[model samples]
Target: MLVEKNLPLQPFNSFGIAARALRLARIGSEAELQALIRHPDWSADQTFVLGGGSNIVLTGDVRQLVLKVEIPGRRLLRETERGWLVEAGAGERWHDFVAWTLQQGWPGLENLALIPGTVGASPVQNIGAYGVECQDRFDSLDAIDLETGEAFSLNAAQCGFGYRDSVFKHERAADGRGFGLKGRALITRVRFLLPKPWKPVLGYLDLERKMAELGLVDPGAQQIFDMVCAIRRAKLPDPALIGNAGSFFKNPSVTPEQCADIIARDPKVVHYPMPDGSIKLAAGWLIDACGWKGKTVGHAGVYDKQALVLVNRGDAEHPCTGGEVMTLARAIQTSVYERFGIRLEPEPVVL
Candidate 1:
């Protein structure tokens, strides 16, 4: 394993914010990772595990060593009466992996197609879209303890998957109240459990519209996959063209009474009642209602197409700083809270 110093991070993250890592290492295999933990010079340096860099915002130069996961491979490991069991290395691009699985006739991940990031990062955020969450199809994952240099695995429940959250997002303390893997575990591989007799998930209104437009009562998996991709492409700007993280904030959930209170004032508030007693509010609607869409603050701006996304209006010569992004984000949060009486939580991991 080679360790490089003073590496530029501008190209590593999706936000396209200019930054650098004090030291960086590209890890392609488990053995390489083991070597890193055992290396006398680099082993003890504080480190950060970077996947596809799709879900992170670099505020400034990162002092810690950055481990860029590059593990690669994909295959159907086994099949049971229940479904097909597929395994992909942590480094595989999430969207490409979804396409590969569909090409191989595994259809469960179609709803999540077109999401940016690596397979390893998927479980960390419990990434979801349309109507499916990673927890719904996750089987297990292999991760190495950053502290002990030991390999371990966790199932769905062990992952503690919640809405845009997982155990990996927290930290352990002396009291043991918040026990999270956080920087303590580096994911090496991930496995997916795509069930047998795959069925379509077109419960979302957008998907329903696509099905109706196509005049198909039952759309196949591939059809659904194409539909999701098309919908995302139409609604969300491509990062290569316009630098951005897919969604800027999580769709905040509220109680039924709170929903009624908001609806009483604004009859057009978009919301959906959940399986539980809570109701999920459309964060984008709240932001749009507060009049932040298509507004620019310095180099950071809200995406005109979708209010939920924040974009970088900068390029090589003059780029947007992460602080500006955060400033704009905070302003949006303040406005939404003042108008709706609810706090808006940003979705990206700001570093």
Candidate 2:
């Protein structure tokens, strides 16, 4: 294991936030991970497990070991009547894993095509897009307990998956003890239950429309996957070319009664009733309605193409600082809350 100091973490994170780490360690195997955690330098307050760094905003230099998990491999673990259970290393790029699964004929992950992040981080936030969340297919995760070297397999329920929140993300503090905000539970691997049977979830209207345009009647999972990629490419900016963390805010889901009230106030509110009868309103529409689309307060601004995404428009003198991003997010939150009585929450982990 090579441990470096004062490492630049800006390039690692998708947002391109200029931040450094006091110490950085890249562990390629479970043994190495355990060794580092057991090292004298390790502490609950000074250890952080980073995956792809796609869903985070760094405010300043980290005073800890930004441990980047590099373990890699994928395999079919089991095959039952329902589906084939596939397991992958936590460090695997989520999009690459999705593509590999599609090629291997796994059906469940196709709808989640093109989402940026690592496999381990998927369950952390129950990462979802276009009607599919990680919890829907999550079987289990092999995670290392920071306090104890003993490895434990956490089932989906054990992970406490919630809307953009999980046991790893929202396990907060009340009085004292507990991991609270900064815990070092290292996710080593993730297992997903997928099916060989082609099940196409064409719940998103844009995807359905695309299928219709292509004359696809009851398309298969792969077809849906291709369409989703096309839609995403047209809608979201590529993080490689432009720095962004996909939808910066989660679409606020409210009760049907609340939706009715909002609809009465502004019929233009775009909302879709979820399976549980909860209504999910478009975050982008809300932000745009608040007059933030294509608006730039500094280097950080809302993307011209998509209102839901905040972009770091390459440092035109005043680079996109963390403070500016926070300010814009606060403004949007305040406006949306005042207008619709719904408070929008930032999806990214702001440090």
Candidate 3:
């Protein structure tokens, strides 16, 4: 274990919002994670779990110790009659894991290509792209309770997954406070249930239309993976190159009645009703309708290619500050709220 104090975190987060942590720790194994949780000097409430740090923004210095998970390993756990179950350490980069699974000819997770973040954070947000979310293929995960340093496994149902949410994210105390922070449960490993029978999901109009134009009746997992990568490359700016978290806002899910009312007001309002009866509306369109496309304020600006993504247009000599990001975020939120009577929440975790 290594511990440091007053560390600057500009290199850690994708948003590039400069911030400092009071203390920082790196754990190399699950046992180390458990030991840190049990350390008398460290309080669960004062510790925060950090992975690849892609889906996060720090508006200010983190007052607690940021524990970065360094444990890394991946392998196929078993081969069932129907599919293969693969387990990966939570510290693994999400896209690398997805590409690895594809190399093995695994038939799931292809639609999730190029999503930023780590394996552990994947379940926290039910990370998804194209037309598939992580929950669709999640089997289970091994987590540690930060208070007692006890390990436990949670099945998919126990995860309580929803659009960009999970029990891990929505954790609440008996008094309606937050859990995980005080308990310090860290996701040390993730298990994925991948189907052997290839099921290409092209439900999104862009993908479905592309397939239709190709005159293809059925596409395989590899083809879908290539198409997803191409589409993502066309829209999302690679964090390694431009430094951005993909899709700064989630598509707002509303009630069918709400959707009907909005549609009556503006037929251009696009929405799709989920099987669960909730209607998902395009946040990008809403933002664009508010005339935020290609809009720039100071060093922070909305990406011209995708209104859902906010980019840092500032350079090294004039980097965007945390305040600027928050300011722009507030403006977007206020604009979307005024337009549709619903507040648009930022998708990335704003620390």
- Highest-scoring model, lDDT: 1
For model 3, which pairs clash?
Answer: none
Order by TM-score, highest first: 1, 2, 3
Tens digits of per-residue lDDT, candidate 3, 158-261, equal 88888888887754677867443322578989999997675788889878876787776788887888788888888888876676767989899999898988
- Model 3 residue 348 CA deviation in Å: 1.2
> Which 10-residue span in candidate 2 carries the lowest summed lDDT?
175-184
Compared with the true structure, the alpha-carbon lDDT of candidate 1 equals 0.92
- lDDT, candidate 2, at 135: 93
> Model 1, which residues run further than 4 Å from truth?
43-45, 176-178
Model 2, 1-351: lDDT tens digits are 689999988788998877798988996888998887687766766677888999888878888778887889899998888898999999999999999988987789988999999998899978988888899899999988777766888888778777877788855566766543237478889999986564767878898799889999888778888999999999998988888878999998999999898889889989998778899899999998888898876677899888999988755355466777888888889988887788999998888
- What lDDT score goes with residue 288 in model 2? 88
List the global CA lDDT of all models: 0.92, 0.84, 0.84
Best by TM-score: 1
Q: Which regions of candidate 2 fall more than 4 Å away from where they truly are?
A: 172-182, 316-318
Clashing pairs in 1: none
Looking at candidate 2, what is the lDDT of residue 66? 81
Q: What is candidate 3's local distance difference test score?
A: 0.84
